[model samples]
Target chain A: MSAFTRFTPLIQSLPSTIPFVGPEAIERQRGRAIAARIGANESGFGPAESVVQAMREAATGTWKYADPENHDLKQALATRLGVSAANIAIGEGIDGLLGQIVRLVIEPGMPVVTSFGAYPTFNYHVVGHGGRLVTVPYVGDREDLDGLLAAVKKENAPLVYFANPDNPMGSWWPAERIVEFAKALPETTLFILDEAYCETAPAEALPAIDAFIDMPNVVRTRTFSKAYGLAGSRVGYVVTTPGTAQAFDKIRNHFGMNRIGVAAAVAALADRDYLATVTARIAHSRERIAEIAQSNGLSPLVSATNFVAIDCGRDAVYARAIVDTLMSDHGIFIRMPGVAPLNRCIRVSTGPQAEMDLLEAALPNVLAKLAGGQ
Target chain B: MSAFTRFTPLIQSLPSTIPFVGPEAIERQRGRAIAARIGANESGFGPAESVVQAMREAATGTWKYADPENHDLKQALATRLGVSAANIAIGEGIDGLLGQIVRLVIEPGMPVVTSFGAYPTFNYHVVGHGGRLVTVPYVGDREDLDGLLAAVKKENAPLVYFANPDNPMGSWWPAERIVEFAKALPETTLFILDEAYCETAPAEALPAIDAFIDMPNVVRTRTFSKAYGLAGSRVGYVVTTPGTAQAFDKIRNHFGMNRIGVAAAVAALADRDYLATVTARIAHSRERIAEIAQSNGLSPLVSATNFVAIDCGRDAVYARAIVDTLMSDHGIFIRMPGVAPLNRCIRVSTGPQAEMDLLEAALPNVLAKLAGGQ
Candidate 1:
């Protein structure tokens, strides 16, 4: 059957896709369960006991729509960030918030700037909204903040996206450089500073929350998905000037939040000791992944996030084969970048010791097989 | 601080608004704890014990993102609906789906049609997307099927909304007329056949699942929120042709579904006995609400939903006073319609006996005060 013949030209032009194939989809396609899931940058250490308890407690009350105002969660976030509740806007995840931000800023054919190999979900949203993308390549595996600002000016772009402790490459720019980039951008250009992995990054790598508190042009997005290990709960929030934050209220699906997720996130925020313990484990896992890579004669990139991007010492084709071989032959799930040069590396998320052991054992075998075949 | 200088003109034109204030907001504003929660059409009876069990079970696995394909939930929903999984598109809720649907078909200035006060959230979405709402007023408190079709033809509108077992007034039309309305619409005029209250409505009031299955232009939206009692779970779906259903995947937040919510919805669908039990309770509560309205000399509209619209024999001011007085004097929460004539009635959701008893006790006293006042 044909689709309704009248979908706006832009929607009709788009395709159903995701930035990365989920592990569940891989398991289904390969007809095998994933023995080790170290992909998608999800923290496999799991949420704090308090968060699980909160989710379990909130489960029975799943008949009431979450408050449209998201009063409690926003207040909790605001208190933690030392900002007022009006300065935060909560969303399903950074992915959902990206879509809303695109809708707010980009009309058809409007230019948006971002690194060519940055978060694909942000690009998906911009294209879904018919925004024209102006791509800038990464510099030294990190987002080119200078190039991004220059492109924003050249195109008179209204929006730019920069992820700190970035995805795929697992690289970061220092907080001072980030703040400088934000200050250098034209006032009319709104910058989405995605800090999804902020908790796992080093102290100096993150700006103080107050650094851009007065700039309506900046929205720093964060999520409980990484350090808090609540990816499936879909809780993410943004901090911006109160005026810009309120703009989300004008068009957001006001009652869209899942109640238990909100409860989980609130509980996760309160469990500081759990967060500290998990980050230490993540740091250990990152070291283990790098060790595995170096032992296999691969170059592991220095990472500030919860993942290690190891250069496979070959082209995209070789990296692709190793990724497929790991999952198909070993039941291990990992990912790679979509763009060339970056695609020469494979990205593995930090996880529990058992999964690390599985990855540690699987990597050498997959590498040996690939080298023999080549 | 002001918002950034250049949100798309359309976004800048819109105001931050909520369709209806939530009961939580009411509690916060009035500094009164709600003793009886019957507002906003939530099932105060709550979700099934089985669904709650499922959500609790799913809570620990909150570290992994939900399957973007939503494979299990879609398969289960498809089996129950006797439709292919391809024919269904899952979303956060009907409210979220409405936002997606609007974005799919609407560009700035495009005309969409629905009753003036049918569902404020739907109107909010249309206006949010820059779609011009061509509203047709309700005829005799029920959506005028003929009028909606006429508006679609006159405006050449690409989208129209009609809710069976409608909100606010709790009115409905028979299946035959609804089917006829669907078949008579211009094929290009996509109709949103909102069946939110289908389970609570009389059997004859709803068209069969297959009634408009072949028509690509008719998309039926149903929610676990209304009948299955998973409102906070945020699970809703659309039944349409596979092609149109797939259109949602192109623009939706692919990994946005909360894992526990999906599990809860799937469990809710399987608990048939619980659904039957709750529907009966809803019917009983509806009658009790009518009794309370009649005993107080108010006229209760014939309801096909889990709510009753009681005409208090006055203008919006008197209805508003009753709503306010109920909250302030007795902490009984309820709502009224937004538009004139319909605003003369207050709406109450069906719930457990304790809440019904509270409403039963409070209404007469509130009414007496209103009548005695100037």
Candidate 2:
């Protein structure tokens, strides 16, 4: 394959590892319809009707570029969080924001710290920008705050990422411990406290918005993707000091946001009742997912967010077989962690009752087929 | 004003220079509404009714992330462009794609080349990634292709940008000349043939799709933002060799695209009649703008895009005064070139008849006020 010859050495050295293989690709590759569309942590409960209506209403103005400063969404977010608009920054989503954050802080050969099996997207950005990854293992299925802080200190790393109600394991740390971790980190270390799943997590699991309001080194990343069910709308924001938030303006694609998405986010923020109702639905669905996993002879990890991680009581291969078989035979789409022992579990997202019903019916037969194959 | 102390020296040294101050900012600053939003080069004609309907329908699924692979859109672009899917890369918009291109090829101190007053967003990306810009002056109000090629070779610059049916000046080279320039560049220099305005350009001015299909060193960027009237949709793509296109995956936000926007683009592509109708309308708007400029004692440059650049035949200050007065006094929004001598012109985006009428009525008043003030 003849390629552009003069790509920087860093780019030339990078591999094409997309953060997550979307379910659309899976359907294409496997040639199967996904009946239980509960993969990728997407909310099949869908966006609030009000938010959808807002997007539809904004559709006519699709000819106009979104505000480059993202003024309205930031204003709404600032009001909701009780911070000034200058203290917020918005982007395509957490994935895009993570990429920008990496670019802003990590120079070539710099070190970045995260849990070993955390969000692959962040790792991809780190390596893409030539930042070395200094990873610590998850402790008890939750991101090990002590381990992450220690790695940052040991490497004197300038950047660290931690997710509350984390992906894959659906685990979380207490608000106090999270605050402690943030306060303990060096001021030189720019901590990305990704609260993407915070809305679905228990109240105790989330630090108060004011906790890190004054912390210059701490930027808490949140998304409308999970609890608000606007994942594909691609609205995400970060909360930090005005100075740190302003840094995003220095490097962000200012005109990158889609107009309807911004309207959807602003509407999503305003529909607090809908947000509450959907999060309650999400919590109920999480319970349903855990119940289904437990009934299938698997030990489902306790989850604070909108998914349950089932330990299949075997190795990674067994978990992989279950994941593959469920998809191939039953078209029940779910995902697994990238690294073991995290990989000993398959992650299932909470969705509508119909999707849960499909998972409930399919898992037993797939597990039986797997056992018989041996 | 405290910031994360450990941001890279390059990041610390950078100022918060946003690419374009959004009209929203202007409204806030001037305390006035933008009655005619013809700045930003966004199409006021809007997307096809079918496309808008598609977005409205897709809004419910905003709960799901867009396909990371962008399979269907790539397939559609491939079929339309007579290239394999691997030869295409989709991004948020041209601005977003330009940022990625800069990241892929530029490192600190790398001399990136482009027309002196070409796209500021492109320059923003280059400087954001620490690439020093080596600008070639535009000759006769058009991007000087020959000068750009010369600078690319002289600087041994890995990257160069040239836009056809250009923004700010609305000037273009014929297809043969564009292809000749592309073919003439050294194989080591990666050239960005930005064809964002191709949909509105004369047929003879656009190179054949096959012109650089096999040229690994050349990538052409196009957007739905222009003549397609989907600027707020944030859909843009690049056409290049499969090898070169694959490079975007190495660093792109895999799930960055918004779902409804992709659906809208697909719908817009399918509705060929609407595209033709809108382009014709844009052509008419261009003529209207030209007539308006001529009546105001300004020289309007010939255009092959969705806008016209009116030569105010004055210095940058006078042009600045015209732009400001149009916005402040008449609620008319327009933009102008940033650098002299290109700054002698004011760029106006082609829009609906009502917007044109507003400009027709407002321009003489604003210009007369400027003349009287002097």
Query: Model 1: per-residue lDDT, tens digit, A272-297?
Result: 99999999999999999999999989
- Residues forming the 10-long window of minimal summed lDDT in candidate 1 chain A: A12-21
Score candidate 1 by lDDT: 0.92
**Tens digits of per-residue lDDT for model 2, A129-247:** 89999999998888988889889999999999988878878888889999999999988999999999998888999999989989999999999888888889898999999889999
TM-score of chain B of each: 0.99, 0.99
Stretches > 4 Å off in candidate 2: none
DockQ-based CAPRI category assigned to the predicted complex of candidate 1 = high
Q: Give the per-residue lDDT of model 1 (tens digit) for B113-156.
A: 99988899999999998899999989999998889989999999
Error of 1 at B156 (Å): 1.0
